[model samples]
Target: MSDTQAGQIGEDDHGHPAASKARLRLWLKLLKATKHVEAELRENLRTAFDTTLPRFDVMAALYRAESGLKMSELSSVLRVSNGNVTGIVDRLVDDGVLVRVPVDHDRRATTVRLTNAGREQFAAMAARHEAWIDEMLGGIDTSEIRAMTDQLERIASTNAKREG
Candidate 1:
């Protein structure tokens, strides 16, 4: 069974407790690893710019989309709801980090792009973000990082397809 299916009683070669316990352990291990990475990133973001990870994520997504992206696109990319995107966008817009422009094709549908100030801020923070990611994973060897990244990407893709 996969790690997530670790609910059934498991057995070892000696017939000791096996089934679900092993899966549970795997899940717990994954969770702990994820939590450690997240905490490190959270602290890095906090110290570097006094911003939360979610806000950074939203901004980074906008910055990456050269021509900007619609709220729907942002929502899908960020795996957040429209209301959540709206609030984040509103906050950023208030701070002049992003602008909402009416769509030429659909007036009601607005596209969000980083403003000059937003671009500048993102650029500054981006360098720091890259540094932090590198530092946090510095102990990981290059091959390991690549392998883990590929595995995680595959898992994420499967999950997205499953959940979406």
Candidate 2:
């Protein structure tokens, strides 16, 4: 079959168009699965913890950085714009869950970190978040999960290489 015909039906034996079609399908399935899990997590976070996914994400980043990260650094780590991080950090600061510390050398720059309370709160939320993921993926076998994780990691590495 010609490439266009092979692509249309995913029937090529030699593999360019067929592989492309298969990759497209895989991408769609991955996106759908991700969105499904994300939506569930978002709702769970909202109902159980009275928090939004973005807030949880910000906390998660800060939780990993013990010493704290500057506002710009946090924005970069989260792959979000500074303005977007600003509002969430502001709210978190107001709630006493995070604190802003002035940078010694840069008067205008400040680093943000989780407070003790924030750490405790995130530890609990993280435990539950893990459980939620486990429950959702309960049907998948451990070996299959590992294989898929490896494949995804490869894809990420390849994409990063391409970008760099």
Candidate 3:
């Protein structure tokens, strides 16, 4: 291997480069791309709706569940702590965007669903979000999209296998 390749891999046992170096580089590139897109999304959400990304994510999960979801379910679906969700839910409730209903036959349990106004507001945001994503990824062709999607799916499967 060349000096640069050796530097990248940090020198192998026999003084050659390691095989895992390419995978490490790929992981960093993927992380960078994800952060770039996420930063743009955060800025757009802030400027267009005067809202944060976490608020948008919570609404999105509630939007998908027409019948609403329990507090635990919301936490699990959003992959966030209950405290994080509770703060956002409280703000949204104060804004008249979500309504908390006592679960049937269970006074101790509460479920959250979007109000009519919330539905309408989310629809508007969702439309703009879709457009923003399309604009950002507009340069990538359909074939490349399909190829990348397939590769990512394979990677996910490999990761799942390890966990399982």
Candidate 4:
């Protein structure tokens, strides 16, 4: 049985344990909030930068890696298929935002890294992204945000323990 189902021996029409129902409601709320934020960001990215979120995500991953990453490594880190990574990498390369270099020892392998221009471009976008996020979440009280973060961290830790 799944971790959630383990507590379902006496579930009702509404899925009792009250805690379970509460968690389900919380999950839905989280999903809705995430979608709302993402939709805004998606529209803003297109309007402001003419870039897709996937491209931004790929660039963000590359920015995090100082030495760049292999195509396969990028795929793994981004939780995407190699073909998906290839397309983004191709476009970025064409835009002079990134370069693919052959590995010295591995003739068949190549690594993708951001160029200086890419770094500058992404840095600008990242700052704007941060402001967007702040604006999106500006309505929430700071204390409530802190409390929610702490609760989410506890849930994350619990899930990590279970998965580990």
Candidate 5:
């Protein structure tokens, strides 16, 4: 069947048109919701903290690690390239919120950790972030939220299995 026919109202030889269209609509809705939430978060971080999402993400990762993470490890955890992470790390280091310590027995490697001030700052941001998320998703009840979470997890698991 043609692409247009596949998206039309009736079934073709392959599968039910209604089911395919429903799945397509679901995918679009999911994408829209994700983008909307991400844009709101990016704006919130910028306006409230005068910080970008990338910087917040770097700090968050380090905050969770406590002892900090190596530069390469940070990049890996963030799923970003080393070059992309370097610029954010550089700015954080200059801001005195993050410190770089030379790794033992490794001349070319360094680990990044948040300073005392950085930890305090992140804690405030994290609390606010949680509230923001709660507020945005407040329309959904607890059970619905749990159900949706489980469904999304299933989708992720399916995709992981396919890829692996």
Candidate 6:
């Protein structure tokens, strides 16, 4: 393979180099891989579940911990703003897929949990989600996936530390 063809200096339609390229080619590949994964998940969630990705994401979190999640807690876990959570939750609540329950003794506090139907739907979609991730990782073997996961975790930890 040519030097530029070795995953660096990707050429454009006019045989020109990418306009704005990163020196770290590996990071660029990683970003592209992440976007691919997200796009696949979004399409799958839409077709298989007829649910928007973000709303499904919220429900998936609650489905994992069936007891419930506070609005603030879900916001933190989803890494989204409270207003965004409010919009998603409102739709879910209206559809009877989720319920907002009052905190046992603290009237002001509330938690969100999937309703029976929501739990059932989440269970089905969760299975498909797993399958989709597996299919997306088709070329890679088990060992490679583990190694990639470790490297990503390391990168994430470094960035988190840097931001902190």
RMSD per model, one decimal: 4.8, 4.3, 4.0, 5.1, 5.0, 5.0
Local accuracy of candidate 1 as per-residue lDDT tens digits, 1-164:
76436465657777767854675787799999889988988988898788988889999999899689999999999988998889889999998999989999887899999998899999999898888778777899989988988988988999999988
For residues 1-164, what per-residue lDDT tens digits would candidate 5 score against the true structure?
A: 86565665666577767667678899999999989998999999999999999999999999999999999999999999999999999999999999999999999999999999999999999999999999999999999998999999999999999999
Q: CA lDDT of 32 in candidate 1? A: 95
The runs of at least 3 residues in candidate 2 whose Cα sits more than 4 Å from the true structure, single-residue gaps closed, are 1-16
* Higher-ranked by TM-score: 5 or 6: 5
| Per-candidate total of colliding backbone pairs | 7, 0, 0, 0, 0, 0
Point out the higher-scoring one by lDDT: 3 or 5.
Answer: 5
Error of 1 at 32 (Å): 1.4
TM-scores, each model vs. reference: 0.80, 0.90, 0.88, 0.86, 0.88, 0.81
- The lDDT of model 5 is 0.93
| Stretches of candidate 5 exceeding 4 Å from the true structure | 1-16
lDDT of 3 by residue, 1-164 (tens): 88666655465677655656667788999999999999999999999999999999999999999889999999999988888899999999999999999999999889999999999999999999999999999999999999999999999999999999
Q: How high a TM-score does candidate 1 get?
A: 0.80
Q: What TM-score does prediction 4 earn?
A: 0.86
In candidate 6, stretches whose alpha carbon ends up further than 4 angstroms from where it belongs are: 1-23
Q: What is the C-alpha lDDT of each candidate?
A: 0.87, 0.95, 0.92, 0.92, 0.93, 0.88
The local lDDT score (0 to 100) that residue 34 gets in candidate 6 is 91
User: Which of the numbered candidates is closest to the native, going by highest TM-score?
Assistant: 2
Task: Give the per-residue lDDT digits (tens) of candidate 2, residues 1-164.
Answer: 67554556555677656667678999999999999999999999999999999999999999999999999999999999999999999999999999999999899999999999999999999999999999999999999999999999999999999999
Off by over 4 Å in 3: 1-18
Tens digit of lDDT per residue, candidate 4, span 6-65?
A: 654455577667556767898999999999999999998899999999999999999999
